[model samples]
Target: MKKNVFFFLLLVSYMAVAQDTTVKKLQAESGRVIQKDPKDTLPKIWRIGGLYNLNLAQGSLRNWAAGGDEFSLTITSILSLFAFYQKDRHSWDNTLDFNFGFLRTTSLGSRKNDDRFDIVSKYGYAISSKWNLSGLFNFRTQFFKGYTYSTNVKTFASAFLSPANILISPGFDYRPNSDLSIFISPVTARWVIVKNDSISAKGFYGVDPGEHSKFELGAFLTANYLKDINKVLTYKGRLDIFSNYRHNPQNVDLFFSNIFSVKLSNVLSASWNLDFIYDDDTRLFGDNGTSPALQVKSLVGVGLLVKFGQGRER
Candidate 1:
């Protein structure tokens, strides 16, 4: 079944490319093709930009009538970046993002609050004005160890590369404009890698006992959106859905993320992030330990926003 699906995808891709070539040929023969002006400056082919935010909170009480921690400190930092290349019918897009945070208090000692790292890359060849033959690559993991405390006992939960997820997909991309893209693929491959022996031995994240990786074949769909609501407000989001044919296809996985930001000044901004995820194979969060549950995360922060490198303006 996998071989047949791949063969069909290849056939479709070939036909689309051939049809595009024919259309271009006919247009040129009929003198309908618009000619490029030699005097016009070349469009910039590379775009790079990113944003960074840091948050800090601290409190110290020498002697207070009210009860409070003697000393407390909290810090969080985030980095989001993107780079893209575009010329003629070919385009490439890439992004890398990181989020890490921790908090310390005299009463509770120290605890991690957030941790994440992810990267994505996609390349496309235009098949029409709004459609492209595209391939996408994405990888996500964490940077620091995660733990849960029960009855003052620290328990290991996750770590760097302990639950790394990697995806490779080839399919059709529908991009109507600079701010929206919808990709669909019938043949998507994903590998969940666990480098930690302790995590792997327990079959965490769907890996078999004592195994380092698990493979999945699926149909995947992802939609990305970005919009500037006005001079001060902006919104961006992404939604990813996958159906695993090798396992229970009906029990699909879903992940969604959204960011809303408002500019306060030239260097200051406020932003909020919200994420939701669900995977049938992730049974640890369920009450029965055999089912799946929705997981949600959210954070709000106010900090600096920096922009560099030119991107074709949206």
Candidate 2:
């Protein structure tokens, strides 16, 4: 698993570097001076530097096993990092995010684990300074390395699979300021045509219930906010909501997460994360429909957010 992750990261880094060189070459040779008059006062073309964060989650949010609450004494942890880069005035926004984690049950001295790799690309057309129309494309996979016992047999498989979690959504965004933004995607279509395994585990959020991999309809909404106080403190928050009704085992889920940061320098920061998850489908986890389940998790993390690229235009 570690080797694959290393190779994937190396490949992505190479691709990003190669693409930038191509873009530079094209701009240099194209006789079209894509710049405006010097006195007219339009900002120069420059690429936006990317932003990154590394997180360590603690408490109940750390458990990634099949059942919930039964592992309260468990100590689970998840590590997530993200980056984004785009050109000013460029109508498209691109993003790449990765999450990895494991779970350990202290009460029973048992351990279980899984991880996910997600890459999302979005294209947007600015409606104004505060609004935009966009489309999102996502590619996700579950990296599972553990034991599965069935049919009087036990086998261990270390592999990655993503059954029918692939879909495209057309959405809209509203950004009131640099600190807050909202996105809505309604009447979106989703289909999970095939998966490499029999029983489909949880969906992308790790909070959603299990369901059949087939055609599904849903809506998506996300809210994001960020604030900085002086050079020492900052806060960021995110909310994700998703629902699908047309597929087997109907479900609705809401997930809220926040991060508080203390800057030690221009390039280094310390962070703490809080996460909460709530869902309406108890049957998704094969429950008897007796009560609702909520998952809460927190973490303390420290990492570097490196911005590698030319600064953006004002």
Candidate 3:
């Protein structure tokens, strides 16, 4: 009986040791898995930034040989704001651009030379590595009254919101890199607004006579590109095309804009801007009366720029 009891006690001790060994093996495996697992990192969610430029020029001449104006002054300013967000395959970008200029000459007096206000917002959800489902909204208008100067008279041409354009589109976006994007929308809604009664009465900007606004359904395509040519020069451009299905579908509207900025110093820079537009419904008065034509504008200036905020460097 004593030998049997001793053997049973030995068997119980071995069973306890085996159970402890199994538990230690499971703990060691769990520790390895915990060390091998990747940490969950948070994404950078928001980026906000803006650029502002103010340009000034003045000239006073006493019997200039080149026959320029006796006294002239020009002031121009460009301001742009941007807000961008990215989180978990979703992105949103918003931008506001404004430009205004005034020129004073001894011969022509003080007049406004440039005016523009544009807003763009885009949101996207990634569908693939290079493609996204996107929605875009755009609004464009001018600041103040504009006039056409002639030898005899100065005719009122445009005013604030007189030729405002608004566009909303839901589409697919292709973005191969951070510098380029292309968007295509088969169905788009566009509005032309003429808030001024005088301008609306004349059927300006495709609005019917006595109507304040006009709406159209169309297809819209937009392409945007940004590049740093070198350390000192940067280029940004956008092209927009639209075709009105209810109207003359063959006559597509086009808007293209380009801006090149060269940094001369930390605060001083030179910039060149070019804008082109072609709208079939808009009329321009020429020697042969009224006709639709492509419009072009260009500006070049050296200015002081004040930049702020944190964003993707351009």
> After superposing candidate 3, which stretches have Cα over 4 Å from the reference?
1-40, 150-153
Best by TM-score: 3
**Candidate closer to the true structure by TM-score (higher is better), 2 or 3:** 3
Ranking by TM-score: 3, 1, 2
Q: Could you give candidate 3's per-residue lDDT for residues 1-314 as a string of tens digits? A: 99999999999999999999999999998888444335756656999999999989999999789898899999989999999988989999898999999999999999998899999999999999999999999999998999866566676768999889999999999999989999999999999999999878877578998999999999999999999889999999999999999999999999999999999999999999899999988764565335688888888899898888886532
lDDT (tens digit, per residue) of candidate 2 on 88-123: 534554544454445545443443543446565666
lDDT of model 3, residue 88: 85
The 10-residue segment with the lowest total lDDT in model 1: 283-292
Choose 1 or 2, whichever is better by lDDT. Answer: 1
Backbone clashes in each candidate structure, one number apiece? 0, 3, 0
Which portions of model 1 miss their true places by more than 4 Å?
A: 1-40, 149-153, 286-291, 312-314
Better of 1 and 2 by TM-score: 1
Model 2: clashing residue pairs? 58-298, 62-76, 164-192
Best by lDDT: 3
Tell me the tens digit of each residue's lDDT in model 1 across 185-299. Answer: 9999999898999988877588898999999999999999999999999998989999999999998999898888899998888888899989887655543344567878788
For every candidate, C-alpha RMSD to the true structure in Å: 19.7, 17.3, 11.9
lDDT to native, each model: 0.86, 0.58, 0.90
**Candidate with better lDDT, 1 vs 3:** 3
TM-scores of the candidates in the order shown: 0.82, 0.57, 0.84
